[model samples]
Target: MTGAVVAGAVVGGTAVLGGCAASPTAPPSATARADVTRVTVRLDDADALDDVVAATWALGVEALREGEDDDGTVVSPSSLLTALAMLGEGAGDGHAPFDAALGAVGDERTDAVNALLAALARYEGDPALVAADKLPVVPMLHTAQQIVVDDDATPQRAFLDRLAAGYGAGVVVDDLATRSDALDEFARTHTGGLVPTSPITPDPNLVAVLQDAVVLAAAWKTPFDVALSGDQPFTVVGERVLVPTMEGEFDTAAVSADGWQAVRLPYRDDLVADLYLPPEGSAAADDPSAAEPTTLAGLSTALDDAAADRVLVRLPTIDLESTTDLMTLLAGLGIVGADLTGVVEGSAVQAVQQAVLQVDEEGTRAAAVTSVGVTESLRMPPPNQVVLDRPFLMVVRDTTTGWPVFLAEVLDPRAG
Candidate 1:
C-alpha cells in the first residue's frame, strides 16, 4: 500500500478528535538542546539502548496494526528478507554476535505478529483451513563496530585490535592533523559519521565490558518532488497560510466522522514513512476544547464498510526530510527499564548497550531533484484531491515484522 493512502486512513480517523499543525523550522532552543543531549548521552549505554529500541519498534508496529484488519499478520516474506539483509549489512563482521544477542530476545515478537495476521485473515472471512496454514517467519539482527585510536601500540588500540581480530577484520587508521586541520572531521569520518563523539570513548580497561550493535536506514522507492510543489493556502488556528504541497497518487485508507477525517500514507519501498493526518476541530491537546486525542481504535471503526469505500483521495505531493537518532528516540518511547541503568532478566544480568543512528537530507535539494520533481507534477491533472494542510503523525514501519521503524510529527510543511 502507498504511504499516502495508509497515512490518509490514520489521519481521517484522528481528524475526528483534533487537528494538527506543522512544527516550525528553527534551531533547537536551550531546553531542547539539553533534552537532546541528555537523550544522546543516555543512549551510549548499550544494553539499555537495545531494550529501548526493541520496545519502541514493537510499539510502533502494534500501533500501526491496531485498526487494520490484517490482525498483525506478516504479509510479504521478501520484505522481511530485505529488512534482515539491511540488518546484516549494517552488522558487517559482527553478524554472529549480533544474531546471538537477537536470539536471546526470544520469539515473542514473531509470535505476536503472526497471531495478529492470523486474526486479520479470519476477519477478512478467509476459510479456517487457509488461516491455519503455517506462515514462514524469519527474523534477523546484527551489530557493527568502529574503533578510534591515536596510535596502534596504545592499550586502547590493542583492545580494539583484539576485538577486531575476533570479528575476523582489520582496523583502518587515519591522520587527524591534515584532515580539515581539525579533530571534528577526523572523528566524524572515522566514527561512522556520527557527531558529538563525546558519548563514545576508547578505554582499554572497559573494552571487554562493552557491547556493540548495528543501525539501519531506509526510505521509499518513490520520492516526493519539490519543483512542482508550490506554496498553497493552508488553514491553521483559524488563519490561512501558504504551505508547500507535493501532489501524487498513493494507495491510501481513510475514514471520516461528523466533520472530521483521518488518512494513512504508506511509502512504496519501506514500511516506515506511514503518516496519519487529522481534520479540523479534532486536535488532541490536553483539553478536549483544546484538541481531540485520536486513538487507533477510533480510526478502525471509522474505516468500516461504506465509509472506507467513499473516502475521496487527491493526495498532495509532500516532500519530507526526517532524521532520527535511534538511541534518543528509543529512550523517548518509555523503555525506562533499559535506560543507562542495567536490566535484570530473571537471573541474567544485562548492562546498557550502545547503538547510534543518524539520517540527513544529504544533497536532496527541493529543485532539480528527479524523484521529487516527478511526484510534484502529478497533481496538475484534474482529479479528486485531499489537501494535507494540517498536522499529522508519520510512522516508519518494517513490513515483514510489522515493526515500527520510527515515528515523527509533521507539524509544518515548510519545516518538513
Candidate 2:
C-alpha cells in the first residue's frame, strides 16, 4: 500500500553462508502413504516460535516470487511457540529466558538479512529494482533444533510429535505413516482450509533425527473470492488472450519510468506483494533477446522513480502451483561460503551428514506449496487505471526486512 518511501541504499558488500544443494539429476520416484492419528503438542518459548514463523514466511515469500501459488499462508509466530511449549516435557516458565537468549542474537539477524537480500537480487525482473532511491529493510532471523525420543516407537513418530508440538495452537498432526506423510499432515493441519501438500522422501534411518522443517502462514485479513474474478484480455509478447481478472481499490505506491510501472501491493494481513508492468513498445516487449540480460538492479531504479503515487488497481485473479529446489536458489543468493554438502550442516537435526552428502547418497528432497487469490472491486475511482494481465513478477516479502524468500513469475494465469 501507499507509504513513505524510505531512501537508504543497501551496502554493496557481500558475504557467503552455507546451505543445502540438490543434485543435477532428478531423484527416483517413490510412492508411499501413511495415515496416523492426530496429536497435540507445544513449544517451550515465544521467541523460538517467532523465529520459526518468520522463517516460514520468508520461505513462502521466495516461493511466491518463484511462481508457486497453492493457497496456504505460512504459520504465525505465536502459534508456533505455543505448539513447541506443549511438546517440551517439563518446560515451565523458562520460556522468558529462552526468548532473551534469542533476542540477544543481533549479529545472526544481520547476517540473515544480508544473505536474503543477496538472494533477492538474483531475481531477473524485480520491480523494486526500478525505484530511484532504494530502501534497505532488515529482518531478524533465527533457528532452533530439538530431538524427540520414544524407545518403543518408530522414528517417524518422533518427527511427527515434534512437528505437532511446534505448531502450538490452531493445528493438529494426523495420519502420519512415513516422514513425508508427517510433513503433509503438518501442512494440512495448520492451513485454515484444505490445501495440497508438497511431496518429500526421507531416508528411513535419518527420519527420526532429520525432521522436515515446518512452516505456517496466515493470509491477509481480507481475502478475494474466486467467483468474483472474471476473464479479461491481456497482451504478452504481441499475443492477446482472455485472462481471469480481479479489480479492487488498494492503497499502493507505484513507480513509473519511460515505459513501465511498478506497484507495491501491501495486504492487510501484513504481507507485501510487488508487481511490474512494461509500457507499450518497451524493450521488454520489443526485443526478446534484450529481456534476458535485464537485471533487477536496473528495474529497482525505475521503480524508485515511478513509485511516488497511487492508482486504481485492476489485476487478474491468478491461481498457480510450482516447485523449487532450495539449493540452486540459495547458491544464486551467494550462500556458497560454508560446506553445505551434508544434511547436518543445513538441517536442525544433528544426526544426518551435511545436505551435500545426503544428496550424494540418499538425495535431497525439499519443496514448497503456495496459493494466492486477489479480486478487485470498482466501487471507488482514482485518477489512473492500472490493469495487470501480462507476464509479470510478484514476490511476498517480510515487513521487517525487504528480503524475499519466495519468488515466481505469472507466466500464464490460465494454465494449470
Candidate 3:
C-alpha cells in the first residue's frame, strides 16, 4: 500500500519545520569524505547502546509486521534508522518523538546514530559478488543521505549543518519543479541502480526533500553446496509446503532458552543471520515485534550465557521483495509532528520506499532506496529454519558490531 501525501499544493510558509523562502537553485553534490571521525566510547556503556539499538530495531520490525500483507517480511533496520536520524537532525536535538524513535534518551540521539553509522562504516569489506569469470567480489556498504530541495526553496542552515555533520546528509539543490527525472536519477545512481526510478515525483508546492539510500551484498563464509540443496518441507504456520533448503553442518553460535532455539548462520566475513526457532509445534506469536527486545537481548545474552557449538543446520533459500510506507508507520510508533513544509509554496509531503532481497547457496544481495518528496505530504507505511522446516523469526545482522540490519518473520518463502 502507498503512503499519504499532501494533495493540494503547499503554498506559503516560513516555519522552521518547512524549507526556506529563497528562490530555487541547485547546489553542489554532497560527496562523502574519506576520513570519518569516531566517537570516544567505553566498554561499560556498550551494553546500553546495544539495548537501545535492539529496541529501535524491534520497532522497525513491528512496523513491517503490521503491514498490509503477510508476505515474508524484509527490511533494513539500518536504513530506517538512518532516515529517522536525518529527520531527527532536521527537528534539532530536543525533538522528543524523533529522539525516542531512535532510542536516545536526551541530546544523545544524534550521537547514538553517529556511533552506529561510524561503527558500521568502519568495518568495511568487499561484497561477495561471485564474478562469472573472476573469483569473487566484496562490495562496501553504500549508504548515502541527501536533502533535495526545489530550486525556489532553501533548507535551514543549522539543520543542514547538523544533518551533514552528524548524519552525513549532503544538500542537493535541484529543479524538481521542471525536471523530476533528476531526482529519479539520483536514487538510481546512488543505490547502484537497485531502484531504477526515483520514488519522488514532481509537485509544485515542493520544498526540501530528505533522502537515504543503503545497499549491502555479501558472500557466505562457507558457501552452501547447490548439490546439497533440494526440495524440503516448509511449514507456513500449520500448513506445510515444499521449498528449497540449504543443508549443511555449520560450526556456529546457538542459544536455547524458554523452549526457543536461536541459531546464528554466518555469512562470509562479518555478517550473520540469527534464526529463532521455537520448540516443535509451539504456536507462533501473533505480534513478532513484541518479541524482538527479549529475543534480541536473548541473542546477545546468549553470547555470554551460551557457548558456540557446531550444530547441524538446514535453512531455506529465500528471495523476497517489499515496499513500505515509513511515514505512517513511524507516526503509528508515536513520532509526532513531521513538518515537511516549514518554508515553501507547494503541495503536501510524504515518504515512500522500495526494497529487494535474495538469499541462496551464495550470500545475500539487499538494497533499499527511500525518497522524501518536496511537494506535499506523507503517506505511510523473514525467516528461519532449524531444521528451519517451520515458521521462524530471522534477523540479518552485522556480526562485527552485532547490529540487526534486517529482520524477518518467514512463514512461506514461496509467498513473496
Candidate 4:
C-alpha cells in the first residue's frame, strides 16, 4: 500500500487544503538511520509553558462540546495534543492550523510541546504496578509515542529528529498491511490493557503512522467508604435512572459561581480531579443540548480562591470507554489538508482516538490512545453536601502545570 492510498482511505473524499503545499525539503542523508529507538529528549521546561497548557485545555473543552449528546464521554487532551504536536512539526509551512489550535506560533509550538512533554515526563513510570480498584499510594502516569513506518520507507531525518527532541518518539518499521497485531500489542502494553486494540488499522498503503498513548492510575487522598456505596436514581438528559453511587466527607476546595458549583479532589503527585455541577434547573443541567459549563480557567480559579473545609460528597462509580473519529473534531479546528512533506512526500493526515476511564471508591484509572495515520486527533469535589445526581463535567489534570489529561461529561454513569 502507498501513503496516498492509506491516507485516502482514512479521509474519504475530504478535500486537501491548497497553499504552499508540501515543501520540497531535502531527504535524509544516505547515512541517516531509519531505525531510531526511543531516547530521552531533554528540553527546557519553561518554554511556552502557559500557552501549551491553555491550548490543551481548550482542546478538552472542544471535545466536551462535540460529545454533548452522548450519555457520557471522555477525552485526553494531553494524548491528542501530543499526537498533534508530532504531526504539526511535520506540517512545514502548513503549520498554520496547528499553530492556531495549539496557541503557539512559528517555532514556539515546538518549544511548547517539548516543555509540555518534559513536565508530564516527570511522572512516567510502570503502569503494571498501578491498582485500579484502590487508591494507589504511588500514582502512575505512563506515556509512549511511536512512528510506525513501512519497512521500505525512510521517514525524513529532520522530522524524526524533531519527534525525538520534542516527544521522545521511537520509530517502528513493519509491514503496515500485516503487522496490525504489533500495533495492538503496543496499545495494550502502553495502556495496561485498558484499551486492548490500536485505533489505527494496519494498511499496506501507509508510509508512517504517528501514535501517542497515556495511562493514569491514581488514588484519591481520601477514599470513600465502600459500605456507603449504593444504587440510586441519577438524572440523565432529564430522565432518571439507577446507578451505583458513593458518599463521603472530606476537606477539599470548592466554590459556587455563575450558576455552577465546582470542587477539587486531590490525587497523588499533585494531580487533581475538578468536578463542575451546573445549578439545578439551569439550561445545562436540564437539557444536554445546552452543554455550556464554566470554563477550565473559571473552575480552576474558583477552586483556588475557595478554602478547604469538610463537606459531604456523593458521586457515582464510573466506567467509560470511547473511540472517537478525531477528524470530525479537527474539521471544526480547520486542520484539513495538512502539509506533511516533512514526514513523507505527498502525504496528508487523518486520525482517531480510543479512551477508557474508571472511577471507584478507591480512586481512578484512565487510559487513552491517540493515533494519527496522518490522522489524528476530573473531579471534583465538594464537601458541603454536593450530590452529583445530575449531569456534570470532570477534569483530571496535573496541578504543577494545569494540563488536563482526561475530561469527561457524566450525564449518566450507566452509559460508557
Candidate 5:
C-alpha cells in the first residue's frame, strides 16, 4: 500500500535544537557538520538510562540470533535505537507498538534515548580529524541524526518539533530519487568514510527516511603489545583457523556465571567493548542462538557484581562488516504496520542497518548507519525489477569481445 504525504510546507519560526539550525540548501552536506554538533541537555533520569541500556543489549542479542552468517555479525544498538526512537516519536496510533518493543513509553522512552545520545556526545569529535590508517591518540565518536523527506512531501510540524527537541535531528527536504548522492555524502562525512554510502535505496513511493550514523575510533587504555601478536589457532564455528592474534594481561571488569565468561575492555575514555564468551564445548559457544536468553538479559547485573582485575586474554585481530534488513526484526518486536500519521499519513516503514568494525593491537574502530524509511502504502512501479531467487549461472563479460571477465554458480547470496 502507498502512504500519503500531508499537505503544506514546514511553518516558519520553528526552533532548531542543539545550537545547530537546519540547512536551507537542497544538498544534504550543507548541514552535515551542523547535524553532528554535540547535543547539550541534562542527563535523563537514571532509570531512563537503565531502561535504554537494557533495551539496547536485548535488541543487540536478538540481531545476532537472527543473523545466519557464521563468519561473524555486528549490530550497532545505539544507531539502531536512535533511528527507531525517531520513528517512535512520529508514531501516532502506532506508538504503543514502539513502546512495547523498546520497553519504555512516553517521556521515559524519549528521555532515555535523548540521554543516551547526550552521554555518547562526550566522545564525539570532528570526523575530518580521523584517518583510517592511523588510529587517533584521542578517542572520538561521531554521531548525527537526520530526517529526509521528499521535496514534494510536507512533514508534520509537531513531529519535526519533537525530533528537533528530543533528538537534535536536522531535517532535509530533497528529492529522494534524484538527490540520493547527497545523502551518501552525508553518511560518508559523518562516518569518516568508514561507510561511504547511505543504505536507503530511493524508490518512487518513498517519502521520508530517518537516519542515524555513528563512527567510533579509540585507543585502548592498555594497548596490546605488537611483540606479543602472532598467529594462533582460533575456533570458528567448530573448525580451527590459524589467525593473527593479540595476547595480553590487563586490568578490566570481568565475570563468570550461567555458563558464560565476560570482560569489559576499556577504551581511553568512557567507551568499552564488552566481550562475552559462552562455555567452551557447548553449542552456544559455536552458535549465538544456542545460549540461554538470560545469559545476555542479565549481563549488566552480572558485570555490575564483578570488579576490575587483571585478566589474561588472547584475541584475534579482525575486520568485519554486515548489512541487514531489519523490517522483519522490527515486526517481530511488535512494530508491524506502524501508524506514522504524526509524520504523514499512510506510512509504511522499512529499516536497514550497516555496520563495520575493526580490531587490532592498537585498539578498535567501528562505524554504523541505521535508516528507517517511510514510504506511501500505495506505490509506483519500480524502474527495474531483478530477482535472483533461484540457482543460476552468473557471468561478467566484455560486451564487445564476448570475453568472460568472471563467472560463477549463483546460489546462497550469503556465501563469500
Candidate 6:
C-alpha cells in the first residue's frame, strides 16, 4: 500500500500506478506523509522495462545452479529487489557493483523499481486487484514488507524513513541477540502465511534485516479444465515420468522461433506465468548462455518471435518447493562480492530464498520469501496445442512491472 502514491490522471483499461485508482484509498501514515514526495512520480510504461526482470532471471539462474537437482525451481526477484533496493538505498547509488546487480544505474534504476512497486501498492487490500472473479478458481493474494533491526544496533533514521516511504517497508527493532522467534512470526504474517518457517537466524554482529515478500494464489486467466486433467507422461533425462496433467485451450501470448516454443499464462492480477521449451540440442535447452532461453531477456523476444494466439495447452500439475542459499551463487555471479562496509561494517550477509509453487486445473498458489542474513535472493502460449511433456522452463512475473516473481526448470514434475 505504501508504494501506490503516484500523482497523475488515471490510465484506463490498465490500472494507474500513480496517485489513485478505483480501489479504496487511505491517507499516508503519519510516518509516510513526510516522504509522500517520493511517490508523486509517473511510470508511463514499466512492462517494457526489462531491468528488474533481467536481473531477476539472472538471480534465478543462480538458484538453478544451487539446486542442481530437478525438483522444479522457483525464485522471487521482487522480494530480492525490495531487499536489495533497501541495501542499495543504504549503500548509496554510486556503488557500481550494486548498481549493476539491480540492473539499474543512478536514479533510473531506483525509479524503475519504484514504478513497479508503486503499481503493486495500488492493488493492496483491494479484492478486485488481488482476487480474480470466478474464471474457474480464485487465487488468494499476499504481499508484505518488514524490516527487523537488532536491538543492539542503531541505524540512521533517514535511511529507515526512505525505505518505508518508497518501499512501504515496516521497521522493527528486535532482539536478534536472544529472541529470534519473533522474526519468524513476523515473516509468516507478512507473507500471509505462505512462509511459515523462518529462513533467518540471529547474528550478534548483524545490524539490520530488510525484507519483502509476494504470495499469490490466483487462477490462471485461462484455467485448465479440471475434468480433462489426468495422468500423463513427461519426458526427463533418463526416463519419462507420469504425472497429473492439466489441459485447456487458452487465448494468450505464445511464440515459436528458430529453436524453441514459448507461451504466457496470465494470472488474474498484474502478474503472469510463462513457459519455455527448447528444441532438442538447441542453445536454449542444451547450452544456456547469455541468451539462455529462460532468462527474462530471452523471453522479451516473445512478441517478435512468438505472437499471441489460441493454443491447446496440456501441462503437468506440479507442487514444487525449494530452498536456495544464494550467498555462494551470488558470489559466483559476482553480485554479492561488493564491499559494503560503509553502510554496515564488516557486514556478513547471506541470502536464503524459499519458494513454493502449485499448479493444477484451478490456479497457481505460489509464494516466495527472501531473507538477507545478508542473504538474498512463465508463460505461455499456444492455441497451437503445445504439450509440455518434455523438459522445459517456467517463469512468473508481473505483466505491467515485468518483475519476475518465480522462475524454474522442470526436468521432472514428480521430483516433489
The lDDT of model 1 is: 0.27
Score every model by TM-score.
0.38, 0.45, 0.79, 0.84, 0.79, 0.80
lDDT per residue as tens, model 1, 136-193: 1111111222222222112233333333432212232322111211122222222223
Instruction: For candidate 4, give the lDDT of residue 95.
Output: 77
Q: 1-416, model 2: which lDDT tens digit per residue?
A: 00001111110000111122222233222322223332322222222334433443333333233323332111112112222222221112222332332222322322232233223222212112212222123211111112222111233333333333332112222121233343333333222112234233332222122122212121322334445567787765557888767655545567665566666655333334556666666565432112321333234434434544546666765444333333333333332222222212222111110010000010111112221100010365777656776666544444433333333355555663
Using TM-score as the measure, the top candidate is 4
Candidate scoring better on TM-score of 4 and 6: 4
Candidate 4 lDDT by residue in tens digits, 75-142 = 78877777777778778777778888987875667776666656666666665534333445556665
Q: Please tell me which model should have the higher lDDT, number 3 or number 4.
A: 4
Model 4, CA-based lDDT: 0.65
For candidate 2, which ten residues in a row score worst on lDDT?
353-362
- The most accurate candidate by lDDT is 4
Task: Please give the ranking of all candidate structures by lDDT, highest first, separated by commas.
Answer: 4, 6, 5, 3, 2, 1
Candidate 3 scores a C-alpha RMSD against the true structure in Å of 8.7
lDDT of 3 by residue, 1-416 (tens): 00110000000001112333433355434443213332434323444466557655666566556544465666666666666666655553335665556777533656666666666664343322211222233434545566666666665666666666675665565665545544565555554455556666555555666666555655666777788888889877567789888887666677677777788766655656677776564445432444545566566557534565667677888766666665676556544444422233222245555666667787666655654343433111012224788767777665656666666666677764
Q: Could you tell me the lDDT of residue 293 within candidate 2?
A: 15
Tell me how far the alpha carbon of residue 385 in candidate 1 is from the true structure, in angstroms, after superposition.
4.2
Ranking by TM-score: 4, 6, 3, 5, 2, 1
* lDDT for position 276 in model 2: 62
- lDDT on C-alpha atoms for all candidate structures: 0.27, 0.31, 0.56, 0.65, 0.56, 0.57
Q: Between candidates 1 and 2, which one is better according to lDDT? A: 2
